[model samples]
Target: MLASRNRDTNSLLKSEKKSLLRFLALYTSLVILLITLLSIFYYQSQEKLMFSNQRAELSKYAYIQTKRLKVLHYFFPERTTYPRDPRFKSAIYDIEYKKIFSLLENENIHFNEEIYRAGNYIHFVKLLDTYYLGTKYLIIEVPEDMAWKKEAWKQIAIGSVLAFILFMVFGLILARLFLKPMRDSIVLLDRFIKDTTHELNTPLSAILTNIEMMDTDVMAEKNKKKLNRINIAAKTVSQLYKDLTYLTLKQEQKDHKEEIELQGLIRDRIEYFTALANTKQLYFELDTENVIIHADKQKITRVIDNLLSNAIKYNKRGGTISIKLRIGSLEVSDTGVGIDEEKIPFIFDRYMRFNQSEGGFGVGLSIVKKILDEYHIKIEVYSTINKGTKMVLTW
Candidate 1:
């Protein structure tokens, strides 16, 4: 059936979604890393500027203390009192970098550096021409000001947040742009398949109908064999056509739910594919019970048809196909080229084909999974390469 198909282009494919997430993660991480480096640089620059502004003021204080020390040196043994200031703490160190006398809370000082910071205090060293009270260095200590730090952190936090948001928005847009071509190509391919399958439907139906009506018993033996081959080919095409038709019309088809007897349905589908199985001389072993379930019959039929088709298509010549249907579960297994253990997880993905030697578009299992998922049925796969694969469906 040719139907007006509607699809949402905005939704991403599963592969595309994974790509987008990876890209965003790397992008966001890089953005955060860059912002962190810049924040560290900015904070250091601000701290250096603060230190520079206080350098001249601290130097002036040291000079005044030096002048008072000279006065005290002259008045030694008379007014022998050390100079003190409330604006800053002062420490005097000898030429050997040892403390002579210190008014500073933390007496530890570096003589090599002119100015540096220690715990909760900034120290400034001023070299003296004359040793006053046996002092060669006048060290000034002041409480480290942290007002600039608060401002720097505030700006950094705001900037980082803004930068992250902006980059994430750009990342999403770029990801969409990157996936656009793939999405477009898939859409075009889907449309082409739909159009080609639609044209083949009428001729395919006519061929099958005419073949059924032919009196093969009256034909020559060789002619009958050729007709049988043609019938097999036509049925294969018919099955493919059904699969494609179901996919193209899936959006428009409404569910016609009813009670379906599994035993009868399974027998009918097996009979339908008997000719194809005969081509390979494959034997079928059906162990079925009269299991009944409520669901859309057409959808359930597609599931069974796909399972049977795969078993036949991939089976070895003269191999055995075992089917077990019970009240709670069903298993379809074949002694064919079993799927690789690692590749089993992706078998249900759309257009997933493991064997290039086999002829198929690989939409069958995907369709099966879709229907089973809708009915809340669970399917398990037990497979071993070079042995066999068993598909177990449980409700």
Candidate 2:
């Protein structure tokens, strides 16, 4: 039984570790995906805003040049002439802003029109014109430059660097803060369970011994009855000890199975609880085969001990405790207060007691669960309220 339990425990731990890793992986992947999407959206919007500002600046320049060209055209009316003020860009005209004979004759040119290209100005189409006809020609083009995008990129780099530094600093602090309380809680609970189990060992031994020392035939029936009460007390403590030890042992060592004789292990635990059973006049129906299973000895002992103890503890006086062991399986059944459907789900949880009046820390089933899980053994509990509980293990 102990060997089987250890095997169950180890296998369970491996699966739990695997599940935890997968969860972390999924969570981190989601965070990265969200950050990536937001970064892309932010950069695109920044690019658009930068481009808008550049276009506004170009439009202002175009307006100022338009006014300058109008003045130049009026002065150089009838013929093509070079500008007196060459600081600004201007299109000479013939007599008017339209009609023929500027630097280029009889040709009109369009300015401030989109030529979507790289240079600051597109071609000033006509370079020569004869007198009169007032021709308007010449156009300037300002192409989009990489400078606007470069500025946006710089801002993104600086912002992202700052955000990264802050996230690292706070993320570490947040993780430590969140995990500290949970770690402390587990450690304190483990220590308490271990210490309490140690305290119970001596008293429980004395009770069991004293009960054995009683001579039921010689004493009054009432005295025998009192002895039965003492036996119950002792058995309860023994169950508690087994459960606490089982829990602590898991923390202390890695689970490993050694070859064990299942039939012998089951019989020994039964005998250990035999005196308590006699006190209740409960019959033991142990049907076990000489099966050898590889598992941790201690954990297997705990599994059998917990189940037997629970059976005796909860059973009515003169009721029967049934224990069955086969290759790859074990079951303990009793005529006791069966669990309610709602409570069944939580029966195996640590510190969960269906009956607080029963003297125990409510960790027996939890320890059983832990051990079975390590061995890759599955447990299912069936019960009818106020009737009985049957806990089955399948490997």
Candidate 3:
């Protein structure tokens, strides 16, 4: 039971982790997308502000060059020095947008915009009131300033990283809060099942013990049949009780593996379920070898018992159950209502009921699967609807 509890707890923990991961993945992806957009917006706004702030300085340089050009234009070709400044490079274009003379590094200029960036320079176009020396357009060029961009990117990266960390912490808290109700419900149910299974042990043992001790001899034939019916019913409940107990509390019980003869174990389980099988007129066809394997006996018994129980429970009247055991494998085949191909995949899922016609909690195969997995055994299912089903376990 200790082991079973651990497996259950681990399974639940795995489920919780998966849910949290899915939530975080989606949440973080959206957060990243939003941050990217905001970063782009923030950078663009900063670029516009930088352009605005630098405009006055550039305009002052343009004024100085224009004044110089006017003075040189007044003196004709003799006094032509064409204004030059150490603070900025200048370009002149005629009314046709053709360059007259240029000191700017990049000759390609956008005349339509008053200010724009081209290559590694910022060009500011200024219209002169006087076309001094036939210069209608005055353009100023300066080396591109990317200091603001660098700082903006740095801040954006830091802010984005910090935002992600904070959101992740909040997301974790939300995930746990979302799962609290579900976890509490499961805990309540688990406690109830554990308590119920514990309460059932004493009564189930007494009933089985008294039935086994009963002597049907010298009784009326009708009375003997009634007693037999009682015994079968009691045993059915006993098996269910055992299954519940196995799932609920076996934690303290240490797993003890011993050399077990497969043939004898198979026979024993068959005999144990013989009364239940007889009720449906189902018979077993045993083709077992004297194969010996070392495994936990109780766990192995549960596996065999579940396979046989399912075969008998789902079989048609007088149906044949074939049990074949080999050196490293066991196969249980039944001429019963076979499972649907799609349903077969989920047959071992806990509390999964495919056929509502059958009366069961649907944990039998689930228990069988857990035990098989613990021993690293592989189970395969072959089924055809309305034909039959076969379960093979290969270690």
TM-score of 3: 0.74
Estimated TM-score for each candidate: 0.82, 0.56, 0.74
In terms of lDDT, the best-performing candidate is: 1
Candidate 2 lands at a TM-score of 0.56
Clash pairs, candidate 1, are none
Model 2 segments beyond 4 Å from truth?
1-45, 58-165, 178-182, 246-259, 267-288, 309-324, 331-359, 369-395
Q: Where in model 1 is the C-alpha error above 4 Å?
A: 1-5, 8-18, 47-80, 92-99, 103-119, 123-139, 281-289, 315-320, 335-345, 382-384
Residues 256-309, candidate 2: write the lDDT tens digits.
Answer: 779989888888888888877887889988798888888889888888888888
Clashing pairs in 3: 1-249, 1-250, 1-251, 2-250, 2-251
lDDT of model 3 at residue 190? 61
Q: Write the per-residue lDDT of candidate 1 for residues 105-127, one digit (tens) a residue.
A: 87777888888887888999999
- Model 3 lDDT per residue over 1-395, tens place: 67656755754664466667888899889878888898888889988988897788889888998988898898978896777888899999999998899998999888899888889889999998889989999999999888988998998889889988887888889889998786666656666666787888898889889888888887899999998898899888878888878877552368999999989999999999999999999988989899998999988998998899899888889999999999989999999889988898789876666589987667788788888888899999999877789999998
Candidate 1, residue 111: how far the Cα is off, in Å: 6.2
What's model 3's overall lDDT?
Answer: 0.85
Model 2 weakest lDDT span, ten residues long: 99-108
Off by over 4 Å in 3: 1-12, 55-76, 79-82, 90-98, 103-117, 125-139, 210-236, 263-267, 270-291, 307-373, 378-394
* Best of the candidates, TM-score: 1
